[model samples]
Target: MSRVVFTLALAASGLLAQAPTPGPLVRLYPVALDANGQPVTDLTADDFKIVDQTKPQTILAFHKPRNEPAAPHEVLEFSNRTSGVTPHATVILFDMINLLDADRLANWKALDKALPQLESGESVYFYVLNLEGALLPIHAISPPAAGDKTWPQGVATGFDKVMKASSHIRQAQIGAEEQVKRTFKALEDLANKLAAFPGRRDILWVANGLTTVPDPMLPHCNGDWVECSLYVPHLGVTLAKDRVAVDPYALVGNISPDVNYNMDQMALLTGGHFYSRQDVRAVVNQVTQGAVGGYSIFYDPGPDNWNNKWHRVHVTCERKGVKLQLRERYYALPDSRPAVERMKAVLMEAFQNPTDLAEIGVRTKISPLPDGKPGVHLDIRIDPSDLLLREQGGKYSGALYCLVSDRSATAPLGEPSVLDLKPELTAEQYKMVMKNGLPFMQDHPTSDTAREVRVIILDQNTNAVGSVTFSVK
Candidate 1:
């Protein structure tokens, strides 16, 4: 029988079962600094007030100067040292469908310079917001260099195609307004991706600024594009059909003369800054400071989410002489779904389309082969573990699949293998096995001691969802 069939049979026989309790909430603090390049480390809880809408709320946990590295226990075995709470992971947001030639080059130069200095812990992901949909990673690149020489050339080509396509559509007026709406809708999709990630993530959004399509028949009197670009796109349009006009200037307004106003607003709320000038180094510096200075604060609103709405946050300096400016606010909506459901959403995104996952977990266990060759088995674990799909009724029905990837430069120890996890196994169980049961290469006796190995998981037959990386030395 095929592996999928075999796994399913195993599940039916009750060989696997779910685990109790959900995973712990992973929280990281992001600090945002101002122009003077000072870290806002002295604020107290009372000095900062969180407001969901206009009402006041409590602050659950707060930390200042939260740039310290996670405790050793908190660090992943494969974690990069530089990956701590430092504003190291940089996201390059390029809007091909909406950006002009000048804007495009400006973005490229900034990314090129920024990609190199990323510490081992620091990560970089590139995205392009256009009508083709939110452009996720076409390929994953590791540190030392996130892109090959040819990668930039390829990205430039994609940008050209999107621009060309936009020009073609701009020429057709049968739905001129509609076409623009679709394009902005694509940008909003990009926003959703950003919001889903941990708050205070750094994103360099390079675009022509945000524009709201005109409509004057809605309460709160805001335009649809702003809501879509700011909150949720579909809901934004449904409630904003008669709200506003497409005024790009008002949407982003002076943050970055070049970036879309709506896009900039979203970035600001997420604790990221916008850049428009072409001074590549300067822009990079700004992004670095923005990411480093901003911090993410999380709190539980006492479970009284009776009327789900957006909650606002305001941070003030407790010290008398210091001035505090934070990304204006965040919407506190009720997340009724269990953490597992949320994990699944992220897994689907990482493993399927929109490769936004910045980190993955891989567990390995080591054993000796009959011939005394060191053999290692690895399991890559991801949250919302249901992604590892199993076959049912002769069709693919599982959500996740595991594959072993070999990056070994030398020797023939053995090829990697994919582990077909039984569907009945819970995500937590998968994680435990992957985390603690993974083989340790040191315990294995192998002639080929110099090789790199990775356990990679896939979702929907696309994108690498989770990966465990190690080298046999």
Candidate 2:
């Protein structure tokens, strides 16, 4: 519930995705106010500045303080794709992965009590980190009335519910290896979920905030490892293989590091707010009441079809003396290149198998199926083949993995399809010879017919060698 304002030295690049014509660019106004937690309705548009990087961009439009009942703010816009759904989405990540502090712990309890009282009009997704440190969508709620279908009272509240969920998960009682996959899959589900929604949305992340983990310098490991924790006291860190060992009373938040980048980028690019894990009371109050009645700025950088690049956006107050708060920036839709280009540029460096796969090839498909919902339907299939391992002498041996990345610009999205290709073969490879792959529901296909999907692939060692943009659309 705490607020964080990051003022960065801007850098310039022509990396923005091609945006649709100027209209209503989803804008989140960070209303700065006095310490009393009241809206400073006196501020006007003249008190704000919009900057892309260091260079200030003109604020195309602005609005004064408005309430929820003041006519639902015309924020929704349509995209030009086959379906007119806007590609905007956001998430509020409740980072409870390693909170061990008593005070912050109390804050979390306070939040639980406040959630029912909080009010919001838009549909935002709630994601939490399991004991294993994997992010998962616990539930997606639409403001006040549309609470969780299962638990109409709403998601769990209090330390017991949160800790119990973590304990059960840690004991391998639930969500095992799938925990890691959830880190990526949660995003994918969110993106697809957003696609199902009508307009653009932003993710608002709330946590005990971020801090550092225990380092070897501590009496425990003796310089062998580092400590990881959250931004506030009373918040503890969750260890992968051990129970709580570190004390939260001994830690404090640092600015240089401790901030979670993965969570940051996920929300930033999609036009979401990354609420720091500070002042639990303030954070809870902020989330309950939408924005603080600040300046709502909007811009249309021009149809963003390419869903692949990290675009940087900045907002500055044109008026001096008045402080301005906004998300660090936003990432644009990805580049429109075939899968190969994306792998070479982004995926290859991280995904290669250790042994020595010199090159890799990828294929993808999306199958549509009938669903109760009305929207694009998809059953995604990714095939990774033609892997060449690094040759040691005359013998070629190594493990290869094929990963399918499902990410969309519209939602808090991600899903990774990893295929272990240790034994490679041709289309006539062997008995049952189906391509080793993973299938996921991409979009709920209109009919029962699935659509062929296109995916970018990466080799363990080499960059992108080839891509399969196959489709049944």
Query: Model-by-model lDDT, in order?
Result: 0.41, 0.36
> 63-167 in candidate 2: lDDT tens per residue?
454333211112221111112111122354454543434444564565565445434423434566555656555555333323332331365553346656665
Cα-based TM-score, every candidate: 0.50, 0.38
Worst 10 residues of 2 by lDDT: 238-247
Candidate 2: Cα lDDT at 57: 53
Q: Per-residue error at 86 for model 1, in Å? A: 2.5
Which candidate tops TM-score? Answer: 1
* Backbone clash count for every predicted candidate, in the order shown: 48, 76
In candidate 1, where is summed lDDT lowest over 10 consecutive residues?
A: 242-251
Q: How well does candidate 2 match the true structure in TM-score terms?
A: 0.38
lDDT of 1 by residue, 1-473 (tens): 11322121123422112212132221224443444756665455576555544556555334444355543422234521224454243455565545554455554455445444433223445555544444545323234343343344345455455545554543333244554565556544444444333214344555564444544333464433433333344433321221111112111213453344565555434444444444543454555554445543544444564233433445554455554444454333445765444434543343332222333334343333555456553323343321323334443333344544344453223433334443433555445543443222222232454465554554432222454445655
Q: What does the lDDT come to for candidate 2?
A: 0.36
